[model samples]
Target: MKQNAIRAALAAVFLTAPVAGMAQETDLAKRVEQLAAELEKVKAELAAQRAQAAAAPRTAAPVPSTAPAQAMTNAPVSTAWATPAAALASDTVFSGYGEVNYNRPVRNASGTQTDVRRAVIGIQHRFDDKTKVVAEFEWEHGVVSASDKGESEVEQLYVEREFNGGLRGKAGLFLMPVGLLNQTHEPTAYYGVERNFVETAIIPTTWREAGLGLSGEFGDGFAWDTGLTTGFDLSKWDPASGEGRESPPGSIHQEGQLAKSRDLSLHGALNWRGYPRLLVGGSVFTGKAGHATPGFAANDARLTLLDLHTRFTPGAWDLSALWAYGRISNTEALNATFVGNPTPVPSSFAGWYLQAAYKLWQSGDYVLSPFARFESFNTARSYAAQPAGLGVPATPYERVATIGANLMVGQGVVLKADYQKFRQDKSLDRINLGLGFAY
Candidate 1:
């Protein structure tokens, strides 16, 4: 009986110990699971915060609106008169240009060593967008001439009106709307220090008359200009010929009924600029020549001209060329007595010239242009000279070759130098240098 009681007590103790240990393990497991759930929640919250921080900068960054960009891209621009509003109110847009020249005769008549060809100042006023006035006063030889002391010659004075649709009108003294160089002859615009002989002697560059004219361009690059001007000789009074006389000794008189000796001219030009980098154009003009004397019947004169001008620029190379020809016609009898009957009555006059230019060293603002020109003309061949008298038959033929370069110093300024070989019946080779600017 005593042995049985001891075994039973031992068994009971062992069973109780196992049950208590199991309860403790169960509570510990529950605590660990709760901790794991808290840890997962914390990790998820941290991940979300990090993602929000990374995305904030992108959402807050600046972005351009559409309307302002469209306005900037569609704005209009112009180079001629600035904005229309500014041009209208401004009393005067101050602008002027000048040239200093040194010329030496290589084979001239007097072998002159020095000549100052030009020094001038110009002023312009804008009355409104459409109308403006311009005047230029010039001094030659750096001093007043003895014959006309205290008198400064007027180079140009004109009023211009611009109309809608590419049309404009001008009156007073302005350059003859004829050749390319004749209209754009700012010294910096050309390579040679001086204009070619063909232009000077035959075309007579810088030729202007008192007149009224109209000019305009069509949509497809067509342009036309015409003017009615005083006869070249009718503008002056000759004491020997009597006031308003149409004929004088050694002068060509006007033909046709007396319309008061006023001359009429018509000119037109066609251009194609479809290629943005290259431009090609041609021009023609017809007009009557001025008479020197009154009462003597003037020989009716007609002139026809043709021109080609082009500019091309690709990479570092820039090239330009110009060519022009002129023809004049008149009746034989009127040509015979004209200008002291210099030739056996020249029936016609004709002349032409070609020029080419290339740019060297075109980087940044620095540029150098080298150029050459060849020209020839016959004055009497196109006109009839009366009574073939004296003075070597007025050969009226001239050939000239010129070579030169232009150095662009800065905005509106340039240095030019050239040497010319003139092979005419009466003139010699000449060398010229000039410095000019405009603003």
Candidate 2:
């Protein structure tokens, strides 16, 4: 009995020792799990704090100004941005411009029109310092389908090359460097809601053609560009129609879309910026536009234009002027070929405009410019010779005076208001408002 009792006691002691060890192990495991969870929480909090610190610098950073450096280099700070060549980064760059306009007639003309005039997006890709490709897509009146009252276009698609001695070359479809407005028609670039009458009527503002061109700078602020380009087509001319009244040469322009290449034209321009804050330029274009029409007897329907323009900005005042003269030969022969036209084509057209604007106020991000403009144009200044009574009257062209103010909220955004007076026989007046942006 004594031996059995001793054995039982020993067994109980061994079992109790194992139970105590299990309890201690479970408590240690629980403590390890809690420590792991605490470590994870601490890690998450540190990551969030690190992220906040990294973003704070960017949010509070200031935009750097290069204006002082530009001034020191004698470079004009007119655009308030880096130079085109310097602004591009290693990546493809994107830019765009847009405008919305409203017009109300104050005279014999009826109705008002509001239009989303244009939306343009452009992209540039640089292969290297010497070569780049640029393209622009345009939407007019917003909608894109042919069934709508809107149109879409590839405004620019060109490859440019930089060579020695400030020389540059471009090939493919591009804006013709004829007038000031043709090359820089972003709404914010000009003063008014509508483009000037002289450029629109005579110079054919926004003109572009498919061609190859060379441009370069010479001695002391002199630059020149010349190109061979596809010319207009006289086959599309319809004399008795309202479309012909749009512009002298623009009405017949095919805009380089699968253009008829039978007749090519030469154009040249020279610009001199010898004086500070002043630029003077002249351009010429001459070509036979008939495109070798089959039915016409005199198919050499030649067109020629000469334009002179200048812009001067002195302190608070800005002055701009342009004069353009255009002529078409062999129009009589071409008019005779028109199947059902009651009107005759003009032989000569001329237009001119002068503008002055003063910076009324500028502070911080706000700028106000009050401007005035005077214009005169004659689309049909003289007609091709015919029986006196057979052709329509070609007399004094229209004259106009415009006054306006442009308020800029930022470098790339503007609000414009203007009043226009037509001073001609059977005149019409109008008020215009517009909003514009570019980047």
What are the models' TM-scores?
A: 0.64, 0.80
Clashing pairs in 2: none
Give candidate 2 misplaced runs (Cα > 4 Å): 1-87, 108-110, 338-342, 425-427
Using lDDT as the measure, the top candidate is 2
lDDT accuracy of residue 67 in candidate 2? 10
Q: Give candidates' CA RMSD values in order.
A: 28.0, 14.6
Worst 10 residues of 1 by lDDT: 61-70
Which whole-number lDDT from 0 to 100 does residue 168 have in model 2?
A: 82
Per-residue C-alpha lDDT of model 2 across residues 1-439, encoded as one tens digit per residue:
4445445655554455434578876865665566556666767876796787555432111111101111221111223212344343233667788889999988645678899999988887767667877788899997879598898889888888878876788899877777667777777677888989888889887788899988887888788889999888877777678666668788888787889888999999888777787778889988888777787655788889889898887778777888999998987766656535654567999999999888888888788889999999998899777655556668687999999988887667889999999878534689999998877
- Tens digit per residue, CA lDDT, model 1, 237-300: 2323422111121123222124244456565555554454455676666666534345544436
CA-lDDT, candidates in order: 0.54, 0.75
Off by over 4 Å in 1: 1-89, 106-112, 148-151, 234-261, 288-294, 299-331, 335-346, 362-364, 382-397, 424-427
Query: Deviation in angstroms for 281 in model 2?
Result: 1.1
